[model samples]
Target chain A: MARVVGSRLGVGLALSVVAVVIVALLSSSTRLAVALGLGVAVLGVGATLVSLPAVRRDHPVVTRALISVVVVDLAVVLTFRVSATSNSNVAIGAAMAIVLLGLSFLTGSSGQISLGNGAFMGVGAFTVGIWADHHATTPLVVVLVLATVAGALVGLVLGLPATRLRGPYLAGMTLAFAVAFGAILNVFSSWTGGDSGLQLPSAVVAPHWLASYFGPGASTLTTSSAWLADISIVVTGVALFLMANLFASRTGRAMRLVRDNDVAAELVGVSLPRARVVAFTVSAAYAALGGALWTLVNNAVSPSTYGFVLSITILSLVVIGGIGTIPGAIIGGIIYAFSAGAISWLTAHLGLNPQGNVASQLDGIIFGGLLVLTIVFAPMGIAGLVRHGWRRWRRG
Target chain B: MDSFLTSRNVSDLLGGVTSGVIYALVALSLVLIWRSTRMLNFAQGAMAVFATYIGFAILAPSTNYWVSMAVAILAGLVLGGVTERVLVRPLYGKPEINPIVAMVGLLLVLESIAAAIWSTSSRALATPFSIVDWQLNHKPVALSPFALYEIITSLVVMAIVAGLFQYTKLGLQLRAAALAPEVSRLLGVRVGRMLTVGWMLSTAVGAVTAVLVASNFFTGLTPSGMDGVFAFGFIAAAIGGLDSPVGAMVSGLALGVVFQFVGDYVNSNAIILVALAMLIVSLMVRPNGIFTRSAQRRV
Candidate 1:
């Protein structure tokens, strides 16, 4: 009986992997992939829960961590469902938050500080927008892939020279890259709308059948919202998976070693500059991929969406989430999205005065407070704090 | 616009510089903060905007613009000192990014506060000094009092600041503190207090620029009035080298002149693009800035 049960579980996992691969290849619709991703995410959570009892006896910490994540995911899904009547917007928000989280996790863990995400996003948005609007010829999947590739190439070039610079210098260089890219876009006003940004096409959504399936009770959700949720879920899930896989790889280990001590890493046969470049490249790809998705959702990409403010906000989210941890990034993204969405909703529904419109300046206050407070009190970040609490609970 | 520029090309160039000088002042203020704390005060522009508004409010109650200007400067002094003590003091020994993030936060707070308090009405600030047209070398030259003040005051401030830093004990101490914080601490120097003082002084300088620039621009400065300053100042600061006070002064004037020429020749917005280009070139060719710091890494 035990052997049969084990075989069945293995088959389930194998089938899930096959399904994922199939989805990745054949799907042109971001919405479909997003829907599939959500289903898989749910399945993953459910399976993890089922496995918890078995793991709890041997690897309590791992089991507990998994359970905690499931709980967090539940909270997020619930909050998103409550706030957004449509699955698409919620998905989009989730996807964006997830992408940011993944990128932050990669960056913080790898010891890289880049503000080039803004630039990468700009590139992706414009590319996708142009391809979709002008040619209307490129398949959706093809466009997304192309956007990521372009972003990656740009990131790689920027990363090559930039990796040589460290700390503040690298940060400054990335910032320049972002600003310069914006300027270039403006200079070519005919194409990019110069000071007046170009309009993006309307966001494409999931097919009606798929939307109805997952959004069973989502009578309140709009078609746009459903589509957004679907795409966000898929992209975020995929990015997280890739990042997680990377972290478990030899390359990721090497990157971490380089981050901790470049001199020591060099002594151990790691090329510090190469590692930095690799980290940067990975980060760039993530940003670009995320940017593509963002444009697809907004259906209108502009320069203003990806500026210093967005870069800073991304940085703040990462820091707040716990800098270098996967869970930290995810949680941080959710918190940010929730706070931002809530403030915006409140401002509109309650008809608050502009002065009280926390959304307008809430970012500054929250990030500012978080930064200062984190430096002083929680230098290890939210993930680190969670780890600390878990250890304490176990000890007790 | 072309005819307007064609007729007053020289004067337009001068006018751009006159405005550019204000950017230089704000940039100079940024340099002071960076030198002392190795962190760019992203809030510097916002702080100046806030101070300028306060000056405006004070002047609003009174008819005399000069009196209002004095009151504004004083308000700036107080505001600068308080900001340093409350927001900056905690971030003194933290990692570099901490202060930057905090400053971003401070930026939000200041802008929001301003918006909340002042509402969104654009107040047309009265220029304290009127424009006077004077003939120079067979050409009519238009000179505004604000222009004369900016040129004169910037030069005077530069000279006085240079003298103070080069010759004074406080300057010596501040330099020592910036270069070797641990040694300075060991030497019984009040490094923290000195930093606070640096913030206070730099903020006051920013206030002076704000009022002057606002008066010249003839509009109540928005949260963004100082944005152009921040960007241009960064250029000047970089070109001057982040570490050199004299370099800042020269770079500021040079930037002013460059922008004037750019404004005269290219699109006015092109000046900002030029500034952005300057940053890229400087980072590539001379990351230590034009002044060339031999000791630092040039990445």
Candidate 2:
């Protein structure tokens, strides 16, 4: 029997839509938050029951339904949590995960290496910063949409040329893009705030009713961060779901075919440049979304924050975490969020002063070392390695 | 238009000549690694920076320029060799992306190590010669003694590398090994060792260029100090010919002068944008190189 990937997608799309509607209608309520949490818990218990080997074989649809329910439920629940620190971290992780997913999708699935992922993120970040500063009344959803569109346009402009270019030439252009981003920020200093960069007019706040419902007397700062975290999670969940669909779609197969052999892809009626450009454009859009979310989370945008170093960092994260897998992208996000403190802690224990250069440098040292080691010894990355081990274990 | 070429402009052009050689040196270094390994060394800048840190460690206490220079070069030689042997060797015949990935990884590691050792703060290189501008006929010129040192040192290294490639038995073996490893092996070339040596010499020269470039600034030794140099050098290599040593030098020098004029006439900060534009146009018009003859390209 043909594995109907479309059925899974259809189920996923419907569940996500229903989830979005429920949130939209309720918009804000402690009751809704409690309901979402309890609902997910019940769904989880039922999923576990249905996931028994015999039941899993008989009704795989339940697994698909459970996954969508769990994903959407957790995304909602995360926003209602009151931990500002954790929310800030989650926001960072979500933004990074979004960027990594796009990079992993582009580089892993279609074999296009872009050193300018950070620049695209910058474009989105600055977009929101400028937009929020200029058009302070614009809704968050609208602003994010505009940012995504801006990214798509830039990606289209670059991706059109990328279709003509091959390996070294492509790398060179992307490299130039990353390097020149600072110049761009400088040249448009009037809008960009030049060296200092720009800040959003205010922290992204939850709707008044929602804020009041969740926090009658809570600090606005923590509530705003939680709101931003929820936005980030929801956006990431949507992006992840879309990517999952893309991976299973005919277009995904065409991309794989092109990556493996463009000639074969052409023989099979896939337009090579079109496929490449689609991947590039979509990836850029995803990166833009990540950047916009980050701007909201940080409430500030700077040229230095999204320079070549960040680009390289994003690439290393994706590579070390496992390039092709969703879980790997998540792992990359977790590492990016926590690796600094972990490395600094380790360095301090080794007698390096916490305030010194070695501690600051260890982050890059470990990131670089892991990137190299992964490429040389475990090219499939951590997630891939785990999957390989699991497969072997099952076979044994 | 009249304002474009004043006495100051003449001095600017003169200044370009001295500074151009630094870029030329960078290009020359890149060409060596490319020719030897048939792979672009993404870590070239990081390696150069690390070598300079090695030099700085000695120079800070001893205040001896030449001795530190020698130490830096030797350090580069060993660093390059170990990197090629341990990190890059296993990548042979693998996917092209693997080498790029590996080299980038090496780049990060080297840069991070330098940062850890020296911190990211810029340190003085302590040159013997004065960096003050030389004046001629009551007008300031760009050719300071240190600038002259920068020029002479870079050009000389470029000359030696170009000469070695053109007229030596060692160069021949290195070229043969890179171009036809199996055939060279049959010819008793010790192909792997040649690669290791090629990387060593290449990075040693890179170390020299890096020292020269860094000394141009009073406070230039930092982990990421070589980044801008590397970017332009890569641009220079691209325009010269990824494969040709002499081509890299000529184009690099020319690019430096061109960059200077642009910075002088246009926004200095926007020069990188100009570099990107030129790179795109050049890649479009003459992907093989503006200067070198056409050759088979892997990419």
Candidate 3:
């Protein structure tokens, strides 16, 4: 008992040192510095308090402490630094979070992987884009709702066939659907704006009470970006929370049972096909919802943007974010979102792009290397690593 | 309507026959990989494109198209053998998804490498054959020498592959290995070596298809230089059975006819759409392909 307490105290002290270094790095502008420092101090104290139980032999509390610390850090970043005011990237990221949550809910909870996520996103985006284009007078909420419903319906239809197939067969079938969708969308150019893409109306704020909070002298931010980001994050968070809770419930148990052993599930009087269909339907809806959220933010759609490459990237996101974890999806999204910009920035910083053909081809090499390395080294992805660290810390 | 008759179609179907011959040749490459590895080599078209580009680089100083074709096929042989040895060998016996993902990575890597290795500039390739006039039903029907060569070469290659697979001990060993690698290994067959040979042969076949078709229609080179032929080839292979060489030939020809006449008669833009629809139908009705047995899941 004394040894456990000693180790926990040691870990707490080490984390505090790390926090102090981070604070020192970010200690620049007065307002930002104070905010970040306070946040870190609060997190340090909270971590110290959370570890007390772990020091006394409650092993699970260590995970709880880690998750809480991460949650707090994310909250601080989102609230303080990543201003929803006129920040399109934040809005896009928030929308992606919802989609990721939905995907994690459907894929992780249900034992299925989808390769047609890009297509489903396309459907949602296009549906809303068309609605906004045609009914310029319609309320933004109505258009979004309609798009969501339409996308979900289509998702259900696509998922129907998938109930019978699993693993690579299912993925292959979805891939075929996605390819066909891309081709068909390209052919039906007038409807989907062809290869050029369809433009959508920017999301309207609808003049909520939250917009009034900035006050008279405040730098005005677009009501739409703020409201949309909040709504998407909140809705997606709630949906995912419900999904997680459901997984901890009987329905999730049944799905997991079906996934683990179909014969055993069948013997238990569970309708294997029905459970699969339900899981598929739910997953498709999540994809649709994510797509609609994506359109709401982009306010435009392109066939080329939602093709095979996008599908592959989305699947990569799910893979890299631990196949079955919600936080993993968010982490994966953040990584993907930043990776492109970081690579471009690094290339620019080194004057690499102007360095001729070698510089230009580096992007491909990097991406290929990333794929190979991730598959070979971290099969369970970033989430798996996090879990591993958390376990080690607890043991220590 | 009169030309739709089988014998008459044979005469008026010169264009279709030429295109189909090229498609069948490419489809043969697809089949070789599918038969041996049981995985569709989606990178086949991209590989061929790279080989053709290499050939183009080699032939840039002169207008010797034959030498370019030969050199490209040889490059294809080397490339296929090397890729299988290095990248694909590790992926064997793994889950199908792993290979698919790896192949997608391969496709991207190859495209990026080709773009880097060769300038992104589109080059117009010259064909060895000249335009010629032929008499059919008292009408002056024009037939290019390149198209005629494609047909002749395709037939010859088909015969060669058939003979090699049927009669030669090497062919027997390859078949044994492809069907059951364990059994073949027990029977003293060098399965790994056979796969390498298979890869080389398939890649060479792809190279021939690339040079012949690219020379005929797509003289320009880019990342997507051989994309059209690949699309048509995939359609042909899908239409025919993925496993049957004969089916590949017939389906390639059939797809070519559909593209030529349907685009001529209907909206030319609808050709791809129609092809996609045909593929969807084929997949639904005969997912094992028109010639191969239905695929069975392991577990």
Candidate 4:
């Protein structure tokens, strides 16, 4: 178990270092490259030392999780500070990570498959989009809260029937929900801004007060891109922390019991319906939060963005990240971010015309191939592979 | 003049039934596969679209609709058999939901591959029959020669399938294998082979539906051309009961007429909304499905 934890940390640290290197190489600024390179060197040394045979095995799961969160947060911030063009992509990936974490609880713990969280995310994005459009001065925090509430409310309503449905039936209902949500957005074009979608107000950086307290030079960090990245990291860290705690709770155990065997769970006095509903509601709220963050990052919300494709992609992420695990979700997010970035870089450097649709087609192919390959060969995902390798090494 | 006899109403009714036949074809395919394997082939639409594209490619060179349709059906049979053998065989005895995820993955991969090969733009396939509406009492109605052909083809296919299931030895073996795989295996029936055959037949049906519907119902051969049709077929099959082919046919046609009426009287965008509403309401009222005699807990 100790070796597993160490190897997990080592894997994460190596991924972060690779991400930093990629950002540094992609950026045009020499200063950014030097800073990122130095950070990578230090992180590399630290990770190596920790993974050494002499390292102590006294760290608890909570401590390991905290260390992961801090390392990932720093990596995200550094990546964002260096690359402006890819900031939105990184932020979206982080938001998706948070949503995947939420889904991991439901799918991993409760054994429910939801393809409708995209709609919940859409609701969250539109909540923020509508608010920012109508009242541009409203605080981001308030908007996020409202979005989360709206998501949870919708989730509760959706979860009612979901409690009875299982497997394909549940999938069918959620698929209908996603389809209906998209149609509703189009029908109520006056509010959702129709198929063209709604443009959000420019995302503001740190409020004037916060920036003033940080002194004059800190204002540079308040750029919309930088601020969005910072917000994404903070939200993701908090969500991961909460998710970890939830997974360790009694309710979480009940969820797992319900997932594994409903008959057995019922015999033990677990309220199956209530557990399923709570899981659905919480996951939906998380999806909404992710959606809200997405809007903040992109400064827009479109109905097309939260369609069946997005829903399937989220499912694929959870599966590819290792279902039901927080660390898996983070790794999934990082992989998503890097692959998207790499695809864009390849397209740009190859001088492929974006308008010709080659880039998007290639992106689709990669994601699809990855999804199929992962499901077939590595059902336990990247994290599972690492654990397997660690066990083998220890045995030797 | 009676309001019910209005030309517009009659036209809408005709159009609805016409499109409903197409939906029935796809629904029948879905029902066939579900009954045999107890798995929803989410990639059915993509597979059909792929076969249709292949047919379209043949059409461009040969300009022969019959030849192209035959080619498409054959391609669908092979593709379906290969997929079942390669991808789905390993997934036997896994959790019910795992197959759903795998099918979604297959859907994505197939759709992406189709897009890469054919390009994303919609391309029209030349139909043998005229797409123009036929004359009715000196007025143009919604019924076209092509529409009539599609309706006839669907009915014929369904009849053929029904006949096979009722009268053929192979069909009996298939049914027995689906119902009791272990028992069938003990009885010397090739259960695995039957499952593959089921996929092939179902996929061929889907391909036929795609070919029939593509020219008129959709713009043309695009990666997402069959998505809406797939959704409607799913709903129709669900309403009819996933196990009942006859039910799928009836519900699909009924849904077609209802959606046509909605499109005519209400907003066109509300069609999917109405379909979803129908699905939810049906599931709530009769979880076992409207046609099934036995209520099986699918979850």
Best by lDDT: 4
Better of 1 and 2 by TM-score: 2
Local accuracy of candidate 2 as per-residue lDDT tens digits, B1-299: 33333376676776788777877877777777777676778788889878878876745666678889988998999998998898889998775667777777788788888877777888767788999886666556666898887888877787787677679998898889878989999999999999998889878988987888777855478888777778888888887878777788888888888888888888788788788777767765777677778766343
Interface RMSD, model 3, angstroms = 3.7
What DockQ class does candidate 1 belong to? acceptable
Give me the displacement of residue B288 in model 4, in angstroms.
2.7
> Which tens-of-lDDT digit does each residue in A78-137 have in candidate 2?
555445776787778878899998888887667777878999999999999999998888
Colliding pairs, model 3: B241-B290, B241-B291
- How far residue A205's Cα lies from its native spot in candidate 1, in Å, is 4.6
**Per-residue C-alpha lDDT of model 3 across residues B153-248, encoded as one tens digit per residue:** 888888888899999999999999998999999999999999999999998888887777666764566754555576677677766877787898
lDDT of 2 at A149: 89
The per-residue C-alpha lDDT of model 1 at residue B139 equals 55
What is each candidate's DockQ, to 2 decimals?
0.26, 0.58, 0.26, 0.42
lDDT of each: 0.67, 0.77, 0.68, 0.80
Worst 10 residues of 1 chain B by lDDT: B1-10
TM-score per prediction, in order, is 0.81, 0.89, 0.79, 0.89
Error of 4 at A257 (Å): 1.3
DockQ value of candidate 1: 0.26
Instruction: Give the alpha carbon lDDT tens digit for every residue of A318-339 in model 3.
Output: 6667656777777766665566
Q: Write the per-residue lDDT of candidate 4 for residues A1-396, one digit (tens) a residue.
A: 777756756664665557455543443345565466556655754664555443334444544454545455465546545557567667778888988988888887888888788888999999999888999998878989999999999898778866666778777678768756778787878889988899976755678775675456542355667667767877887788788778877999998999899888989999988999899999999999999999888888988999878887887888888877887888878776677778878889989886666666877677777777777788777878888899999999
